[model samples]
Target: LLLLGLMRDEDTSDPEPLDRSGVDDDRLRLVFTCCHPALGLDARVALTLRVVGGLEVPEVARALLTTESTMYQRLVRAKRKITAARIPYRVPAADELPDRVHGVLHVIHLVYTEGHVASSGDDLLRVDLCREAIRLARLVADLMPADAEALGLLAHLLLTDARRAARTDARGRPVALEDQDRGRWDRDAVVEGTAILEHALGLGPPGPFQVQAAIAALHAEAPHWDATDWPQIAALYGELARIAPSPVVTVNRAAALAMADGPHVGLALLAGLEADERIDRYQPFHATRAELLARSGDSDGAAAAYRRAIELTGNAAEREALTERSRRALGR
Candidate 1:
């Protein structure tokens, strides 16, 4: 009976684990290990997007606020350093996985942030980067099955990615959550994300990523934006802020409050955050602020905020989207 049960377990288990111990893993390890703190942030961003996110050289350069030649040189230098240092691409020892995971989280965070509100051109969102980060997160989660943080990170990315379909209109203009077509959401992503989130929660009390994942999941399960559990989302965001406070989190929490309470309350919170040095040039800061203002019936101020957001945009698609918002806000 014991032998029969063992056989059954073997059959039901995953056929293959995505082990981070092969040559490819070694190369990935080398890339992150070579990422010296001395390098420029721009160079780091470019290398990560190219090597980790599989972005083309041109795409990376465009995103980095530099020409292709300059971007290529930076990548070459980064690669040379990895080769010279003889950095191995293999996964760190189990004892070192936590530290290694911190590094991986940083890179994935950078990739996702770039996608959320690109630093340079026109389009606001980079679906490729977002997808790549989710892929990387999955690999990390599989490698550290016992780590709640890994599961949480993957869950958060998956749940957020599920919203991509409703984030924009047919013309790629930004679609406010309240006006988004819930029917258009990516159902598969939501289902997978929900499963990942449940696993993360089962592992332990929620961590930062788990809280964010919960917020995303709430948004995902809502039949429509109007029916969203805004109070729960606000509470989750509050927990996230305590765990990983940032201007971005604060803004998102305020937005959740606005949805739950009223736009005026949300507007005050947004106004209070206007001078936060961390968000001085972040396009989404202005974009969200504009959205609140627009809702508050300050069309002229909203138009100005939207225009500033346009000026700071990086992706072409995002720029066009912001321009449309500005035009509409200005009643042009």
Candidate 2:
């Protein structure tokens, strides 16, 4: 969801750039139609993932955790509804654009997110999906050139994707951002992304995507992990939490807070967030809590949290890395 009003004080001085590119207007309109607000959130996501993200029906089914037949039926019903309701397959007029941009932006974000860090797979990074997402993002940005959030999203994807080359080790193990080799990052993409972000920020009212882009921009600007402005990143995450509250956001905020303050402070934040039962099943929550516990000198607690995280983890490389950390935490 492209939220508003939470980051009135967000820094726009160091504007980041976005990917500037062309798009097939027809394709862009078709995607907007697929993401029309008339459809259910699941339907919109499934349709956009299937049509715009270039995912096979089965892939979409797997991503959404539904049977192929069920997903097929849902897609069929959604298309029927669109036609029966006489939804236009063309771009909306200026007056109608605002109502639809939210869904379009959200679905695109989800596509890139799943691609950047696959929810379930043997491999950590899905390059094909990532490329498709970037392509779709470029289309969205081109279609809505003045939309700050659109540009912000494109910049966020580009800036994050710029570090793809260094996200894993030669042994195929996932590398944490703090440990990645900056030399391996794509400088060209970084430059392009920063430019886009600057334009998005200059558009005035910043939203969720712009805030996220700012966070990524900060990371990109840092010369080393130690040099990262943890205080500012944590503060920004606070704004993100206010704008768009989610368990995942809370987890990220806690982790960043830990870096800025102390492990105990981060653990306090997590403790409050963990009251939500959904957090129990989220891998990142446990993974982050485990690290915090380890940092706070609670070896047994860290090991236990790591075990829970390992159980929830899907990627094989990530699982292996967590296993190693678990072993180290237990002094095995």
Candidate 3:
């Protein structure tokens, strides 16, 4: 009878373990291994999310905006590469650490970015994904106490996340940063992020992450929207553009220029981007153009630009917000 009961219990037992407390070390090890320099950056991101972040194949694929089959093949290939190359499941040696660590940081940043603004989803923010990224980032920061970029990345995430409560209205419409309620901002996150940014800046000359963190810090420190250091923010954007040189950065700089100099100046900068085939269809480009046009008293032009932006974006929340902006622009 005892043997019979034991067999029945074994048959009914769960195949997977219920407790995951012991998996943290394994997760960290997998992340470090997946981020090995031997793998491509895309592969590193895919593998790390799959093995370390504990994301399912379909979820990772959705975040990457790729098909499940494609993502599955990518994960399989990454695993094969790891095995065939004999990449050790451990942190890199001190001599080989810096280069490898950058890839890991990039993966973590990508994860956080997807969470902060999902590639394709109904919800504007995926709280679970964002929290997971923060958890992994914290682990990375803990593991590399002296890495400025890691700390800066964490600081940036924290500072950005501090505004989560005020990012949307009661009805779930997106709220512009300038209009968000400062009282709702996470004070503890702001304080921690500021300390982290200061520590990172003290480490050495600022890298791209450090520079971005500085920008976030300035925003967080501002008492009010009008009191924000627009000149300093624009200066930081200039520095970021010099270092990064992406179309997105250019658009951001244009927005800052509108705040610092004037809407006309910002519109002129955006005009060049609008004509560029590479970013002409980019949603943010049109959205920024809409705002700058509205600020310049071109109501009709602003309405048209907002319509174009609405057409380009897929996020329902962003679309609804753009529609509202379009309505306001048209005085309807």
Which pairs clash in model 2? 16-194, 16-197, 16-198, 17-193, 17-194, 17-195, 17-196, 17-197, 18-196, 18-197
**Each prediction's whole-model lDDT (CA):** 0.71, 0.81, 0.78
- The candidate with the higher TM-score, 1 or 2, is 2
What residue pairs clash in candidate 3, if any at all? none
TM-score, every prediction? 0.76, 0.83, 0.80
> Where is model 3 more than 4 Å wrong at Cα?
1-27, 42-95, 274-277
> Which 10-residue window in model 3 sums to the lowest lDDT?
1-10
Between candidates 1 and 3, the TM-score winner = 3
Model 3 Cα lDDT, one tens digit per residue, 1-332: 22112223433334322322223465555667788788887789988776655567876775554668989899878877765665665555555667777788877777777667654557677777688778877887886779999998899889988998898888777898989999999999999999998998898878778888888888999989999999999999999899877778889999999999999988888877755665755778889999889888899889888888888676788788888877776686
After superposition, the stretches of candidate 1 with alpha carbons farther than 4 Å from their true spots are 1-23, 34-51, 54-87, 116-125, 329-332
Which is the better candidate, 1 or 3, if ranked by lDDT? 3
Ranking of all predicted structures according to lDDT, beginning with the best and ending with the worst: 2, 3, 1
lDDT of 2 at 19: 18
lDDT for model 3 comes to 0.78
> Could you say which candidate leads in TM-score?
2
